[model samples]
Target: MTKELLKSTLAELSLAENSTSIIGIKRGIERETLRINNQGRLSSLPHPKKIGSALTHKYITTDFAESLLEFITPATDSAERTLNQLRDIQKYTQARLDNEVLWPMSMPCFIKNQNEIALAQYGSSNVGQMKTLYREGLKNRYGSMMQAIAGVHFNISFPKSFWNRLQVIKGDKTDSQSFISNGYLGLIRNFKRDLWLISYLFGASPALCSSFLEGKESRLPFEKLGKGSLYLPFGTALRLGDLGYTNSAQSALKVTYNSLEEYIIGLKRAISTDSDLYRTIETHSDGSLKQLNSNILQIENEFYSPIRPKRNALAGETPIDALTRDGIEYVEVRALDVNPFSDTGISLQQVYFLDVFLLYCLLNDSPEMDNEEQKISQKNLEQVVNFGRDPSLELIKKGASIPLRKWGEETFEQLALIANWLDTAHGTTHYKTAISELNLCIEDSDKTLSGQYMSALKNSGLDNGCFALELAKQYQVKTQEHQYLELSESDLNNESAHSFVKQKEIENSDEVTFDEFLTAYFK
Candidate 1:
């Protein structure tokens, strides 16, 4: 029945008028990396001035630490154009670093202590101070080492015309916003159910320097590599596993994705509720704020998830408010590991595959997920991240165990159909080619990124840090030699100069004290 429904949906969407709508799919990327010294230690220097102010820059900004740089690309319909923009942004930034290089992996290089990680600074503006305080709270809750782990985020949204056609095909009479929001919610539910496949195919973080553990206890049976690294022989992406960016405190929230209202209500309750565990932590120290608040979550962004339904919030508006008012404008996939093989951290072929996968999520049959089903999904993701390449691995499906390879093969067969439709829509073979290449990874675990990365590490007889450092140096050299593709050097220089001016304007416009600002924000 599910297969028939998917087939019918695709058939309806294949009409000439509806097929053209697929060409309008928009996408954007946000890639994060840490700046390291020549020796691969985390850089202690402040954000580079030549890269623009992290507070106001539109394209370049700091995420958690001052050394953790985030590069963003504007939404575009062309995958090639998006990758070009990302490459140009990275190239421009790399040329400006005096003696620092961008780390090429999802895991951190080396850290002597927590003191080595500094919260990102955004000048003297009230909003800037609040940004730093939020990071301070994250450090208190999860530790700074976890914040150093970086990844790539892919944001995508179908055109309004496609949604309109989908609504017509489904014979729905609801309002436009209601239909679109519900459609995206269904997509989120399906994505959550099947995202373990993503981990098994594209996950790249198999090992890490022991320094990242920071003496913390873990249950994974990690083996020692060289003298300072630890790894799981068949691990795909340890960054998404138990010791990575997970929040144990959030387990009680029981957030559901059945509807936009339910999702918003859950998040609202979390931000408004105070936590007994966080209450003991000091909010103020030495006449300076240590954190934004002692709530379970300082803001909606603090709630971690593999994917998010997003709408660009206006000034002074919270993310949930924006969603409640205008509904979801796009969905951001946050589960991707930074691809070590690509200079841009994500390849164009990966983007092509993602387009097909997300469309499949949108068009497929998705039912409401109960708490039991949610638990199963989480467990499946955990299993894949830890032992994905193990031949004996199995995943739980509807209370029945299925071999990992069997499930993956079935998923890919469906994805192949969607890829063909996309190819016909664009009059090109790129989507088919991408699916064909990735399908091999499903057949043979050794073809996956994690497998290749581990093989390279073993062949060189170098630890994770040493191997990543070598790649970082090579990437820096290549970036310097390459010319800009989508953006020019002059364009980036102007953006940097304008960002400085914008930062100054914001600093001068602050009229109230930060305490008053925080009160108004929460109110």
Candidate 2:
């Protein structure tokens, strides 16, 4: 359907429902962990027990490293509830921390010594061991600096009611699971095509402490910021830019979102596809396992992309296996940079804008993306990540070039209508306000997050470490002082205790040896 038709359809549908559609928009946030001491150095601290076990806790877990704490929220329809839960996790964590502060920026600040940063360690259980082993493989494959760069993942899914209504609108007769899966794939295609917009608008890691770039190659025109920071005056998100180690191998995968089956086939092939380069890096000499396998992908999760299709994996199932078996339960938008300005690293406006944009992706025509177009999209994303604030910047479309502001403004014009439709549905102007706020960024480049961050950095003597350390402490205090919205202290404590028991149960239940488990899991 065209934009006009979609607008009318939304209007009609909004009136048909007793209230608004009140569609279920579930969110799950995963951010990598970092904690620092009073000296503003990366701390060598253990995961606090009061916060909950990283192994089995539903709310808190470790991602790439032990210091990289990943907070997971249950699928929540209310964005505030999701943020509240995330804040509670951070709140309790901050209070329990002796003197450590969570690192607020995506590109980490000053690490007193890079050698001191360690890969995550898990316990003796087979599952925990495998988790730690995966980190080891990541460290070996990509240097610790590459692995330390952190960002946020936003997982989104629509309710069955929304799908049923959409199917009725389109006269679709496929099974609900398959239909929803295809719908999400369509969303993914559009998101990839336009994802450069996200990096331009929301990407926040434009600078880093010079310490992070130690013994590494950087060609950008980086200016010295105070004693430690090095930043690109025009950089959007250095974390997402042409970082050498992160994108090298995955770029060759060429995974497409044309269809759910096609996407799965591509990933499955990658998992089985061996890499000559990887084979040269022997993980172990013993008969025991080395890095899952000498494949292009250690597992499906190894294939990095700005966005991904996901499902809650069944016990013993891999991410790809779960999505293939159950269809796409949600699309994980991995393009978000950690917003330093907010106490929670995300704002209600960001969340609401995401809702409107994803809905637009669903309603808009999402043609299958070919390899050439995919390459173009990748190029556009990289450019935006590094130099998006450039007024003369141009982006590719259908083998043609268009001015970035023209394209961005045109996109927002449509988003305004989407925002209105959302406003009518939700009985609030939150969506429209976010759209208006972003449109201003297009109108004036300096208003954009990256631009604003750069301006602020200059005012602070261009010190990323100065701002990061202070902001981390401020956010920690804000989180600690905020009243619990959904969770009581007692509830959080019980969760921690029960989660510890669950971890023990998991450890006790593992019957197979680590080697056997890895072999079986890889297969």
Candidate 3:
């Protein structure tokens, strides 16, 4: 979570300075574990008992000199570094590809937990284990600086047809029953054909490729492209779209967390208070509904943020490019569910897989997409999403009838090539090991996180809650173990430096209100 997001959520929740933590309590027996004091108020997660003290008096004195000093000085070193890294990466990749920048699209997926642990907690608008995992990840990767990261938690509804299409892409079109997108109520209602024009954003731009390489090999950038520049095969499911987590449907990916002010600015851009994009479900009384709706909206907006508004010479271009120029890189990847049966939230194997995959995307100089191709890409995408695992899924790249498993294998091979290249360039065999593990996983499906999850759930009598909760518990354990080695004293110190800089700025900042800052900055 971003610092600005944390502050806003804390403020909105009326949390006091003494409040140690904010838990997301859901309905179910788990509620017993995560109950609230005073009035039995249900939270989004469970919280511990006796959380510090109540609120006390606080004040601030604002002046012009303070404001100028604040304006001129950055909130944190990480803020500058993160933004610079994003800019450098973007510039290098864009120059290498010699194409216009294209913003990544995040797609949302609504998964159904067939068996919830508790009745009250089952199916509530709460992220239980996921929240724990997110917080844990922050502590390990960014530690206290994690508090400065900004992001949001939002839900999305997609038709069952989405999965069905993936099945088709996997060549299971004959399963007439598989294409039905009518099971989940949320998807059936919210993901009607009219609202979402499902489309694929192809890996590369055909026009750019044609311009750059004059040969039969250049038939549309996505065609028969072995491993994409993103390093993964064209078929490897990358949580690139908005579903969040960079890959998950509701991840806090692309958050600017280096500073509180930048995080706030990013939040405002993500979900405007006045936008009609907000979706409201009528369940309680009209008055209650109104209040709940508004509150929930506020809750979401306060999470993910956007860059501070500014006059752009390139007004209607990709925000990714814009943000990159300003020294910020969006870390997209959230779709991955913690394999419930895995000892960890994910595996070292999976982690390595991602490393190679991401490096491939970064290093591979692919083309961008055109308006016409973008439309066709959507159709092609639907085919894969719904029928990805089928034996005869029709890929966008013509003349391919390979089974999904085979496709996965082929993609891994390409990924291995990239991993080898990375090893040569960076002298790090981490990518190579990741690739090798991925190949091994194909041979032993039981070792795959998803496979393990399904098998465990089945063995556990299809208990979804137990499965989920167990997944969460195991993840907690694994993360603690993995963390010890990844975060060294130096890394912790760097994070401390980042935090110290931000804290000092907060202490010295002038009284220029956030609104004022926005008006002046944008104008």
RMSD of each: 1.0, 1.8, 22.8
Worst 10 residues of 3 by lDDT: 62-71
* Deviation from truth (RMSD, Å), model 1: 1.0
Please report how far candidate 3 places residue 344 from its true position, in Å. 5.7
User: Could you give candidate 1's per-residue lDDT for residues 362-428 as a string of tens digits?
Assistant: 8898899876798899999999999999988999987999999998888888888999999998899
Full-model lDDT, candidate 3: 0.29
In candidate 2, which residue pairs get closer than 3 Å at backbone N, Cα or C atoms, i.e. clash?
Answer: 33-68, 33-69, 66-120
lDDT of each: 0.91, 0.80, 0.29
State the lDDT of candidate 3 residue by residue for 103-220, as single tens digits: 1111111112211111111111122222222333322222222121111111112223333433443355544332221112112121111011111111111101111121225222
The better-scoring model by TM-score among 2 and 3 is: 2
- Model 2, span 179-278: residue lDDT tens: 8999998898889889988888898988888888775678888877777778776778887777632647677887898988899988988889888777
Over 4 Å off, model 3? 1-331, 339-344, 362-365, 371-386, 398-406, 424-430, 440-447, 474-523
What's model 2's TM-score? Answer: 0.96
Over all chains combined, what TM-score does candidate 1 have? Answer: 0.99
Q: Which 10-residue span in candidate 1 carries the lowest summed lDDT?
A: 282-291
Best by TM-score: 1
Clashes of each: 0, 3, 75
How does model 1 fare in lDDT? Answer: 0.91
1 or 3, greater by TM-score: 1
Q: CA lDDT of 483 in candidate 1?
A: 81
Which portions of model 1 miss their true places by more than 4 Å?
Answer: 284-287
